[model samples]
Target: MLNIKNLYASVQGNQILKGVSLAVNAGEVHAIMGPNGSGKSTLSRVVTGHPQYTVDGGVLEYDIGGQMTNIIGKEPDERAREGIFLAFQYPVEIPGVPASEFLRASYNAVGRHHGLEEMDPIDFDVFVREKMKVLEMDDKYLDRALNVDFSGGEKKRNEILQMAVLNPRLALLDETDSGLDIDSMKIVAHGVNTLRSKRNAMIVITHYQRLLNFIKPDFVHILYQGKIIKSGGPDLALKVEDKGYDWLIK
Candidate 1:
């Protein structure tokens, strides 16, 4: 579970997130929808301890296994090791690293942090191949360099694959639907849906409601001008899709 209160954040010298407060509990999915420059992505980065965003004031806390811990000063890797996952809006390519090698290294690193046994190559291949079935991914992808020359859909599916493998406690998806075709969107959504469980929470940040059609959120939030202005149920997304943020912003 995560709790944020009156959070303010800035990049460089300009303030972005102003007085943003939200709570997410286990077994719930929250969708954050907003127009351009509304600090939607900033909120996700701030939560995951992105170095560029500074927490100017207020509280950002995470209750990991019944203990309330403040993440204000935590490093990004620290937060990630603590079970926080952020799927970037635009995944970057690591030109030389093969996807399989990268995934195995990442999985083993996280495993060591959580005191879980590391998987050997054979075991990891079987493990990852099984999870690949959820996303309909083929083994050919594993042999390619990470995200290099991958289509938009392939990159998005790759992010979902990473998520499925990590199985974090809280997942923040920043525009996972962007630039994805219908088939790709469904594949990504299916991977997310398959990963959903009562013990994990998801915060989906999107501009349109179409992605929500695939992954139903328990709560829908409208974030505008660096703060969350309105919060409602799934119907809220439909309203935004129909009337635009103008109806809610005004």
Candidate 2:
């Protein structure tokens, strides 16, 4: 579970997120919707502790063993190790490192953080292959360089693949629906739904309600001008689709 209170974050010298507050409990999916420059992506980066962003005010906390652990100054890697996962809006391409090698290294790192043994190469292949099934991915994908030369859909699906393997308690998907076709969106959404459960939560940052049709978030929030202005159920998304952010902004 994650709780943020009046969080203000800045990139370079310009402040982006101002007075943002949100709480994601276990098993709940919260969809954050807003127009460009509303700080939806900023919220994701701040939550994941991106280096460019500085938290100037308020508290960011994560629950560990029933205690509210302050995560404001935590390093990005520390947040990842503490079970925070962020699916970037645009996944970067690593040209040389094979996906399998990169994924295995990341998986092992998280495993070590949780006091679990690292799997050997052969064992990791078997373990990752099982997870790949959830995403309907091919074994050939593992041999390719991470996101290198992958289509937009492939990169998005690859992010979900990482999420499935990492099994984080809190997953922040930053516009995962961008650049994806309807079929690809459905596939990616299916993968996300498969991973949902009582032990984990997701914060979906998106621009359109189409993704909502598939994932069906438990709560919908309209984030405008760096603050969450309205919160409602799934019907809120349908209203956004019908009336647009202009209505909400007004």
Candidate 3:
């Protein structure tokens, strides 16, 4: 559902992603693992059309109906409307906006894009609650300002909750396991696994294999020096876990 070809991107004039390429099809989960500053997070941000990163070369394409269309110039919102979702490493706090209010606004915006009718607050509350159930979240979260004073684990779970609500066709989870404990990671993984379907795909980026133990990606890739240097089955992550990147880097 998504294809990135030899993508070269830079931030603040310093190149980060150099000649990176990968293809992800529907129903497949791919895990990207690499050392720090190896362009793992850069790939996610570039794919999501982050304004700070400029794509200097190569094609960014997505299946926008049934055809692979180049999306390099598309705005971030345009990409989001096209079923591209990014779960941030650090979810920012919005002090005044209730989580429910924020979620409903996003849901309605995406719904409107697809010619669907917007749900009223009462109706949306019912819909969002069901999604919250998938994450085992309580109703109190709905009233709190988005991520305001939420614990690290709560913030991570909230990111997964947003993914459930948006139901994006291509989900890019950037270090979702960051700052999460084992139990919390399992809960977040459960919510992610529940959302897996034949109509959607996911690219999970992380620095460790423990997250893969819960999420269980079908494919594992080793990204190094701004490029994907190795690709294999789930065992690849195990190899990385057993032996550090230096073995592969050598």
lDDT of 3 by residue, 76-174 (tens): 988998899999999999999999889999999998999999999999899889888878787799999999999999999999999998999999999
Off by over 4 Å in 1: none
Worst window of 10 by summed lDDT in candidate 2: 241-250
- Alpha-carbon local distance difference test for all models: 0.94, 0.92, 0.93
Over the stretch 134-218, how does candidate 2's per-residue lDDT look in tens digits? 7778779999999999989889999999999999999999999999999889999999999899999999999999999999899
| Per-model root-mean-square deviation over C-alphas | 0.9, 0.9, 0.8
Clashing pairs in 1: none
Superposed by TM-score, candidate 3 places the C-alpha of residue 80 at a distance from the truth, in angstroms, of 0.7
Off by over 4 Å in 2: none
The number of clashing residue pairs in model 3 is 0
Please, what's the RMSD in Å of model 2? 0.9
Candidate 2 local distance difference test against the native: 0.92
How many clashing pairs per prediction, in order?
A: 0, 0, 0
